[model samples]
Target: MTRVDFMQGNIASAEGALAAGCRFFAGYPITPSSEVAEHMARRLPKVGGRFIQMEDEIASMAAVIGGAWTGVRSMTATSGPGFSLMMENIGYAAFTETPCVVVNIQRGGPSTGQPTLAAQGDMLQCRFGSHGDYSTIALAPSSVQEMFDLTVKSFNLADRFRAPAFLMADEIIGHLRERVEFPDTVECTPPRPIREGMLPFEPEEDLVPGFTPFGHGHRVHVTGLTHNEKGYPASTDPDLHERLVMRLIEKVERARHEIADYDIENPDAEVVFISYGVPTRSVRQALLDAPEGLYGHLNLRIVWPFPENLLKKFPNARVFLVPELNMGQMAREIVRHCDQPVISLPRLGGELHTPQYLLDRAEEYR
Candidate 1:
């Protein structure tokens, strides 16, 4: 049995986190993303969870990291400016192998560019924003139901990969109100516990280390500095640092295709549109409004690690059209992955790419 109701996307995200066994939320309110924190505030304590409104995004992110260390699923929600503020701690989470979730309801940006609007400008930033090399899992939702489903998924992915996972929605999807179906009980994947003889940072065969929970009768040192399997700082050893970072990266990258979530339709069509997040709505609408089998679409839900192989699934694709809210941020990724001519359709000003607009653009490429 399940429950169905009209739900706002941000609220659905909060509920999703709760369903995923997320018991800690620390966030500062920001437009377009604040409702997630608000909903968590009203809902968390009732479930015996903790919710805190920190001074700012930086502190919120740090609090999330601290909460995760205490052996709980933790998260924070913010938009562009707040996302930027959390970069340092995000890097810390990556270095220390902390499992947490960060909800970035992206808005138009560069410095509070458009607080009330949406943009996919942070597409690349979420993957490479921090100082050093690292990898993360990021999910882009095109609907309210996905906001709920993917939040749960982010938690599970974070636990599995032992790093931060991102729910990268935007103002459009974050604010959209739609009917959502609630599962009877969502499954939660807890981190693997420390084995009897393994060190804190020592990885299993999968390149991911088992988690050392607090009060497990084991004391483990944690730091962001280059560390050994025992979690002691070893910043001076070049080879150890290289091995550590590479594992941090490969744990996610090596499993990228397995982690990828996308849908393909009309695979035989010559003109393929690759998209994610809200811009994908336009492509779907365009396909629906056109003749059957006239075009193909690859809609990606997991954008990070790029999932370059999905493009090859459409063997007959002669051209791939990419429509993004940013200036072709993701389109550039497609350019490198395939030989087909890729047409980038970029839109600004917080507007959806109308189906007519998409159809008109495809017409020009022919």
Candidate 2:
């Protein structure tokens, strides 16, 4: 029989990691996200997995990448400042096509603004946080249960695509406690397979070929440079580089349908509520309070590799309102893809959006 327990969102995330076959964890403890690390520290050992507290976030990220290369599913948890420190390694994971989960329980800041406060300010950073043209996969969970479910999905998607998957959360959700039920046996998908004795840079359809671990009898050369089939650094030929980059981009872009998650409520409603992370809870409440056929919503669980199809659903919505704990970052994306009037309801670190606030906005827009 399955059991249900009340747990903080961070703990739920860690439980999800364990369920997803994550056997290795490396991260420094930070506010809100520290509990995730703590849970892993205790739980992983019992499961015969490994857990290590690195000196900093950079090393933590590096260790997880190494663990992934060794054929172990791995993850790390950190907040905003630590996320900044892990940016370079995150890019490294991207270029190497290493599969790992990064849980960012977002706190305020450009640089440690509010360690205990919540913010969705890292939305843009998750997409452009690292310095590169590579594609990123990120998921935002609005509730504690989602924190659990999405963490497992993050690992599955990361292993499936051989890319880093992010669980973008905030302090409120990370620290909040809620009752969650678990299945009898957790199911985790197997990693994608690279061609036999495959060359690292060998291009295949959908842009991504299968993968082989280092020292696995494959002539695999991993680097952050533009390369060809042999994986050797090759940048002089413009055509070769263009083809290489496009393949990487297209792999995610082409698979956008398989990668995005958008829940629509009352498709014919005049007003649409757009939000992610913890702010989405408010949007849900607003939906509950709204009259039938009055309001619609798009709750984006997967932020990166943006759901182009979902946006097309309400391209000309009468009014689209995005509320985030930041200065209109995601709202800009909605505006960019949407051919409609997008309204901004920005908040900074400390304050969180409430159902009442959204109700007021719905009335104002109506």
Candidate 3:
């Protein structure tokens, strides 16, 4: 039977990780996200799993990578500052194709801007912060229940792509309390092991190499430097490096359509609201107050890779209005894909746009 409870989002996310077979957690406490680590510390031991609170975010990220290579599903949670500290190692994880999950319950920041407040400021950073040309999977959860659902989905995507996956949430949803339904069992996709004769970094048809866990007698070599199929450093060779990097990108990019998760409402309307995360709630409210067929909504659950094809679903769209906690981060991406006029309704300093605010914005375009 499914279990239901009134839970906070961060706790639900931790429970989701546990259900998805996360046996290892290494994290440092940070505001609005600490509850995740707190829950993991309490719950992991009961399940015979391990939890470690590292000295810093850098150490936390490294520990998760080590745990992943040991054949255990690993995860970590943080907010803006900690997420920044993890960038270098995050790049290393991407280059080495380590499978792990990182949850960032975003708070406002250029540098510690608002620790206890809600903000979606990390949306672009999670995609490009690592300083490399590698692709990754990121999920955005709008509600407490989605916090559970998407965190489980993050683990599955991490294992499937052999790349770092992220849960990019915000303080609003992370701290909100709501009833969540827990599944009897969460589905997971175990990493494919390398065949005996195959090289460690060898790509299959999908461009993702089979995982060779440590202590498995596979004699696999892993490194952050550009490597060949045998996993030896080949950084000096131009073509080999290009091939390696391109495969890392294509593995996720080519699969965007298959990975995309979104909802389209009133597709034929001329005025559209493109949104994700907490702002999506405002969009929902606006739709309720508007005429039945007056506005279209594209609520994206998976934000990275941008799901550009979804734009075609609204052929009659004359204007696309995007309201987010950050100042025009995703709006720029939307502008690139559609010729329709894109208006950015940016909010910062930890406040969500009111439903009336969105409706007023849409009214102008109408």
TM-score to true structure, per model: 0.99, 0.95, 0.99
Clashing pairs in 3: none
lDDT of candidates 1 onward, in order: 0.93, 0.86, 0.94
Candidate 3 overall lDDT versus native:
0.94
Across 103-161, the per-residue lDDT of candidate 2 in tens digits comes to 99998887879999999888888788888677888999988989999999998888778
lDDT of 3 by residue, 1-366 (tens): 999999999999999999999999999999989999999999999999999999999999999999999999999999999999999999999999999999999999989889999998888888899887888888999999999999999999999889999999999999999999998998988888887788999988998889999998987889999999999998899999899989999998898888999999999999999999999999999999998989999999999867999999999999999999999999998999889999999999999999999998899889
The runs of at least 3 residues in candidate 2 whose Cα sits more than 4 Å from the true structure, single-residue gaps closed, are none
The TM-score of candidate 2 is 0.95
lDDT of 1: 0.93
Candidate 2 scores a C-alpha RMSD against the true structure in Å of 1.6
lDDT at 115, model 2: 93
Residue pairs that clash (backbone atoms under 3 angstroms), model 1: none
* Worst lDDT 10-window in candidate 3: 189-198
Query: What digit string (tens of lDDT, one per residue) describes model 1 on residues 1-366?
Result: 999989899999999999999999999999989999999999999999999999999999999999999999999999999999999999999999999999999999889899999999898889899999999889999999999999999999999999999999999999999999999999898999888899999999999989997777679999999999999999999999999999999999999889889999999988889999998899999999989998899999999978999999999988999999999998988999999899889998899899999988877765
